[model samples]
Target: MKFNNKIVIVTGGARGIGASIVQHFINAGAIVHILDREFPDSFDVGGNDSVFRASGDVTNSDDVKSFIKGVVTKSGRIDSLVNNAGIIRDNMIWKMDESDFDAVIDVNLKGPWLMCKEIAPIMREQNNGRIVNIASRSWLGSAGQSNYSSSKGGIVSLTRVLALELGKNNITVNAVAPGLIDTPMTRSLPPEVFKKLENTIPTKKAGHPEDIAHAVAFLASDESKFINGQVIHVDGGKSIGANLH
Candidate 1:
């Protein structure tokens, strides 16, 4: 019950890591609101009434504002905001389309900025809040992912800046960097490619969505109030430069 009665917002909670993060908050007793383009036929509540689904786009300022307003209108205040919406269009820079790069940056980096902008005042007035941005260990470096890597790196920087600006208000901002998580996206890779990537990881395995969810939950909970502006890598040591030999 670390987050009992708290009002929490998660972007892209329909599936993958976001869905797990939403469930984590729900289990901890937080009233979780999800902002996504569309929720599935049913937003899985597991018989819990603490889940709210708002259909919206994080890249749209108006949508972002409306989502926040709707959540606050219902909950009266916001406690934590997890910016988790992201997409990838991987290709080498030479072969990548300009639109693809823009798209990735807009959704992955700008989306979080919009959410933080809309929530900053509310959290500031409350004088207490938490913000957790989902970055990627690929932000450090990754081939054929120039746009994705750049977007996640921007997330890392944004986390630090927001923590500096919001720390005085007792609002801590942090990030979770996930590496090789076993989600639909990763599983969709060709068998040989997937195996090669898995073999490259120090653990020789891809992490589950719950692993990322747990790290995100910790940053959003009271236990991490003092740990701000940091990026926690839940990558099974893959971020430490895995040995391919």
Candidate 2:
């Protein structure tokens, strides 16, 4: 109940880390609205009347504008916006297809950009808002994920830029860069590859979706009002630099 009567918007919240984020906000007493391309049949909004779900492509400007308008109409104001919608098209630069790169960049970078553009005016008018963008630790570097890495790196930059622009309006913009979290996406990796990744973590284990959600919830709360333009890595110290001994 930390966010009683608050209005929060989470994009790509139908499953995995996004889904976990929606649940956390809902549990914290926020009126949570989710925008996703599609909701799985098994996905549930916990029967919470405060929870709303809409299907739309985050990359579509028309779709993003419509969703924002709908949320404002129903909730009157938006207190927080979580840009959690992202997609990965992993490949070495040489092996990657142009279309794959375009698809990943469109959804991962462009989508968040569109969402922020639509929400900034609302937050500025209110003179208060929280924006938690879901970036990735891969922004640092990843061998087979050139497109994804670049897109996330762009998000990191975008978060910083928005923070500077929106600070005067009392809006805080931050990002949570998750490492190896156990989600459907990661679960798709071959067992050997997944296990290898887990072992590479400083903690010798992959993080859970809730771990990322916890960090996001903190960044989205009033307690973090003073914190802005920062990237919080919920990556089990994987971003701490390699172990050299």
Candidate 3:
């Protein structure tokens, strides 16, 4: 777990699962660069010299380019890129506005795609790198989440294609499909709805952000070099049978 001297960038690192991933890498001794629209107002990212924060929207290609450039300027190299920045605009397919679908896709899928487009060349030149995309089990099928589901599905497909395209350059690309993680996003869910969702899980427990972070950390590690083009589920078995209820 020691990432001594490693340089990593995590998009959406200001909150929730992304924050957990940043903290994990920072604790492991990596020079962590975080890209977020803004740091969460409540928490503090102080006291860590190895942690660098960049404020910008991931959906903007220019912002992503500048952030990656800044990371290279400060860290001297890019060892890993966690494409964790995303958003959800949920609604039934028939009820969903085109804008909702486009927004979700722009942030969730296009944002990561753009990050990869910018950072992959750096990795290729160095001949070593890891890219982990944060996706969701909702991609399987979720009512009232047409926009969100489509975006995540796109992530899975993008991960596989990137793996094939990047492996030749000694870069590994993978993804984590998380489900029911306890985070600011889920905290906004209505109590009754959240409870019912939990009740359906075999684990009967919502996942922590760290649950997903651990998977991303592993994928980013050298130990997982051969495990590319795969989407590992961190859903407490939810993908298997957590919804049988």
Candidate 4:
């Protein structure tokens, strides 16, 4: 029980990587609070009575604040924050609309920005905390994803800057850049496109949300106290070389 007695907040925890992260933390004996617009179907997570659900939009300041306050009211303190809420709007820069870019940025970038703005003070007072931002490998560059890539790239930048500013307070900020992971979003892709994506990964397969969760668990735990301000790539070596058939 690495996270025993800890309280963690996970945004977008209803599905995908966020859900996996929530379950992992709960399994490790941490009380997990999920901030998301919708709740997931009932699933047993360690049977420890460690799961808390808060329904709200991460992009809305009021919603974010309320969710945090609710968590604090129940848990007294937050030991870790995982900014995992994100959205994708695929299109080239020339074709992308201002609203589309803003929507993606609002949720993917500004959402976490607001979370930190509200929660960092609590962490500062506690004199120790961990914040893990979920970014994407597409931040390096991606075709037809100007909005998503830019939003994720901004997360990478935010992670490093926050780590620097918060380190003195014993708060470590880090980002996890995941490659292709099988999720509801990717499941919608055409079979041909999905196959191409798999062929490109060095592992010849897409990643799983659990893979990213494992990385996050380590960063959120005491073992990674020395690791900070890093944008860890959870990709399966796909970032090293473009998948070419």
Q: What is the C-alpha RMSD of each candidate to the true structure, in Å?
A: 1.2, 1.1, 1.1, 1.4
Q: Which number leads on lDDT? A: 2
lDDT of 4: 0.91
How do the residues 1-245 of candidate 1 rate in per-residue lDDT, one tens digit apiece? 37899999999999889999999899888999999897777657675679988888999999998999899899999999999989989999999999999999999999999999999999999999999999999999999999999999999999999999999999999999998988866777788888888787888898999999889988988888889999999988889985866
Query: Which ten contiguous residues of candidate 4 have the minimum total lDDT?
Result: 39-48
- Model 2 regions lying over 4 Å from their true place: none
In order of appearance, the predictions have TM-scores of 0.97, 0.98, 0.97, 0.96
- In the range 61-132, model 3's lDDT, one tens digit per residue, is 999999898998888899999999888777778888999989999999999999999998999999999999
**Segments in model 4 whose C-alpha atoms lie over 4 Å from true places:** 42-48
Better of 1 and 2 by lDDT: 2
Best by TM-score: 2
Candidate 3's C-alpha runs over 4 A off are none
Model 2 CA lDDT for position 41: 92
Tens-digit lDDT track for model 2 on 1-245?
Answer: 39998999999999999999999988889999999999999999698687999999999999999999999999999999999998887878999999999999999999999999999999999999999999999999989999999999999999999999999999999999999999999998999999998888989999998999999999999899999999999998999988542
TM-score of 1: 0.97
Tens digits of per-residue lDDT for model 4, 95-198: 88999999999999999999999999999999999999999999998899888999999999999999999999999999999999998778878889888888
Lowest summed lDDT over 10 consecutive residues: which window, candidate 2?
236-245
Each model's lDDT comes to 0.92, 0.94, 0.90, 0.91
